[model samples]
Structures are given as structure tokens and as C-alpha cells.
Target: MRIATTILVMLATTLPAAAAGQAADHRVLPFTPSGQGDPQAVVCRAPQKLENAEGYGPEICLRNGIWILLTQDAKDLAADGRSVFKRPLVEEPHGNGPAEAVTCRKPPTITASRTWRGPVVCLENRVWASLYERGLTVTGDGRLVSTRMSGPATDPTGMPVIQTTPPPRDAPVIGGYYSPL
Candidate 1:
């Protein structure tokens, strides 16, 4: 009986350590809704592939180092390079309410390689914007600054969109590259 109890205690201690190690490697990206508009922008981890998925739309990685799923209509607007910060706020056509605007600062420097530091913006019920291929640099004040890309923006359809199954709940936001704004 003493041996069994010792083993149980050992298991309990090791289990937590093991879990913490795994957690350390995994990133938690929480869904942060920005606007007051209806059908709030849904941000979550995207599946590895978007092929033939019903209701699911295009995805983009935010400056916060998290992936988010956008509504179809919102996807369309983002594809056009429109940002809530650049455009005037307006009411949703469906009369849900005034659209909420999201703004992100441009990265301070541009790089030739893929990076998580880029501009990201979204409006409630309207659009989701991102600067693909751009790198991000966090300022001393914790603001996300954008960097320039070595090349011109690629075709939106050609951007690297990884596929992964959506988690049941929003993951906790993690990673060193967080949005300063």
C-alpha cells in the first residue's frame, strides 16, 4: 500500500510537469472581437485546408501571432486591401448596427521572408485586413509596428493558408509577437 501511494504521488507530480511542458510549446490564440456590430468577426484557428468547407471562409494570421477565420463577405473586403483604419466607419447594410472598426499599425521594417509581424484590421460585419508577407516589430511601448516587405504583395489567393481543425473553444493568446495597438 505504501508503494502504491508513492507511485501515485510521483505520477501526480510528473503529470503536471509534462502538461506544462506541452503547454509551453503550444500557443494559445484567443478570439478578440473588436466591434459592436452584429455577427462579430470570428477569429479562431483555421483548418489546414479550406477546401469544400461549409460556412467557413478565408483565414489570416493577425499581428498578434494568431490565426482567424473571416466571414465570406468580410474576406472579400480584405482581399481588396481595404482596412477599417483607412476607411470611414459606416453602418451594416443588414441594419444590425454600426460597424466596429479595427486598426493596426504598419510594421516598422519590411523583410524578404515570411513573418508574423504585419498589419491587421477588421470591422464588425464588414472586413478583415492583413498585410501578408510583412514582418512585425514590437516597439518599446508594446505597440506592434509594421515592417516593409522585400517584394510586392502577392496574390491574395496565393498566400500561404495552412489548414487545421478548429478548436472547440478559443485558445489562450500566446507568443512574443503581440499587437501593441
Candidate 2:
């Protein structure tokens, strides 16, 4: 009983600070996109009117709930709902070449397995990356394999960007593949 009372007292003191922090975040990032359909990816671009950054990613476009999410990376559509939180994700594609990839200098989700967040390409600095993982080899008779994963992607700006999502060591890559095993 005593411990419970002490805990309540602590909450009474910190509750105000927590509320203030959330209010500040809301004020700083007021615009959020509306979307619904299996949270995939999101981007927070320099907002201008209602239109946000197009091309190159899940840029913020419209308003949704408390938090904003990106639904369609191409059309810049806003998500309809908010995840428990946003996920910082990386896009590496292997649909183009055996080792072609583009490395997004941002934080990404740490999925249980490999995640293909974007198309395969070679960036200016030549950072090999892919949205797909495994290799061109598949269980089927010489066919590219792909899978649709469903999960909530956390926000990076609100959260701290941690260790690089991509491999620490640069190496050759290939794409158009998935693994159920």
C-alpha cells in the first residue's frame, strides 16, 4: 500500500512534464496524412500547403490521427490511422541487377527477417542496397519470389535514429526474391 501511494505521487509530478512534451511534438509536427491498409512506410518532408515531397520515398502528404503515416510512397498518400508508433525503415531493391541497390541514409524497421523497402539501385556513392532480401535463387522453377509483410513502421524524427539498418560492410547484391523459410 505504501509503495502504491509513492508511485502515485511520482506520477502526479511527472505527468505535467509528459503532457507538455507531447503538446510540443504535436505543435512542431501538426500535419499528418490519412490512410489505412497495412502500415508499409512513411516520410516527413518539408510541408508546403497540402502537398509534400513526391518521389524518392514515403513523404508526408495529408492529415490522419494524432500521428501521420505514409500510405503510398509514389502518390504521396497519407495514412488513415496511426500505429502504436512509427517505424524507421530502409529500402533496398534487387529487381534491377544482381548487385544494384540504393541506400537511404535513414533509420528503418528491424524486422524479424530481411525487408525489401524499395527498388534495387546503385546510388551516387555506390551504396548497394535492396528492398528485397535473400537472392535471385528461389524454391520455384526460376521465378522471382516476393512476400507482403504487415506491421507498424515507427517514426524516426520523434524517435532517435539508431545503428545503420543496412549492412556495415559494403558488398555485391542481387534481388527479386523472398524466403518463407
Candidate 3:
């Protein structure tokens, strides 16, 4: 009973001290109403209207360093939503040879995987990309090879067409015979 009492006493004493130490050690970052980071610092300027925001929006007051970061983030977010064709050409084509050589009826998906996301358009180079997609074609074994190809395509509810002999990788592309695979 004495040993149990001693352990309980020790725990009771240590718990409050540990909690106090934790509270004191906490490093709280100062967020002042004034544009300046320091709480004691005087307000340098009034809050400015957010220019990038459409229609009327709330004004925000932040330090110069914070403002620059927010502006850059806004610009990047805007560019991300736009199609690759609309933007300047920076990324190289997925396949060999010039991207210009590959004729496209509609804009290519322009992503990591051609059959991953976005609209799948017929390209001279990657004709198989349009094929093997969900609505267009399934494998001979009745497996979904690609599910991401979407747009004006073949009947999704139509009967499955099986290919007995699949063509080689170097076979002539289907959509347009611009060049040999």
C-alpha cells in the first residue's frame, strides 16, 4: 500500500510540472492585425484589394514577403487549369520525332499517360492511344485496357469485337499513316 501511494504521489507531482513545461516551451508565431509581422510595429499601409479575384472580393493586409508568395501561387493555379495547346510549348512530345509531325483532329490529352485522363483525340503517332480505351476498344480477353479515353467515340453498349491476331508494335498506326511505328 505504501509503494502504491508513493508511485501515485510521484505521478501527481510530475504530471503538472510536465504540462507546465510543455505550455512554456510552445513557440506561438505572432499574427498581428497590422501588415507588419511584429505586434508592436505601426501599420504601414491599408489593406489592398485582391486584383486577381473576379468581381468584388475581400481586401487582405499582409507583409511584402507573404504578398509575393500569394501572387505567385495565384498565377501558377491559373496556368494549371488551361490546356497545353493554349499555353506556350515547353514540354517535349511523348513519342520520338517532332510533335508537329503528329496531326491531331482535336487537341491531344497532353498528360503523363495518354490513356490516363482528359479527352482522347486521334493522333497520327499514337493511334493506339485512341484505341484500347473503354468506349472504343477492349482487349480480346474482355479486359478494360484503358478507361480514360472519352469524346465522340464508338458505341459503348455495342457487342465486343475480338481480334484473333493482334498487330505488331511496328504495325502501321490506324488513325493516320503519317509514319511507321
Q: Quick one: best lDDT, which candidate?
A: 1
* CA lDDT of each prediction against the hidden true structure: 0.32, 0.30, 0.30
Please write out the lDDT profile of model 3 over residues 34-136, one tens digit for every residue: 1123432221112223356644321222233432222222211111111112112212223333321232222234344344322322232233334523234
lDDT of 1 by residue, 1-181 (tens): 4454444334333433444434434332222234233332222222223235544332322222111222211222222112211233232122133333343333333455743443333334332223222344445333556654332333354443332444336675332222335
What's the ranking of the predictions by TM-score, best on top? 2, 1, 3
| Candidate with the larger TM-score of 2 and 3 | 2
Off by over 4 Å in 2: 1-43, 48-73, 77-133, 136-181
By TM-score, who's the top model here? 2
Tell me the lDDT of candidate 2.
Answer: 0.30
**Among all windows of ten consecutive residues in candidate 3, which has the lowest summed lDDT?**
75-84
Give TM per candidate.
0.16, 0.18, 0.14
Please, what are the lDDT tens digits per residue for candidate 2 over residues 88-115?
2234323443222212222233344765
Range of the 10 consecutive residues with the lowest summed lDDT in candidate 2:
66-75
Candidate 1 residue 151 C-alpha distance from true site, Å: 43
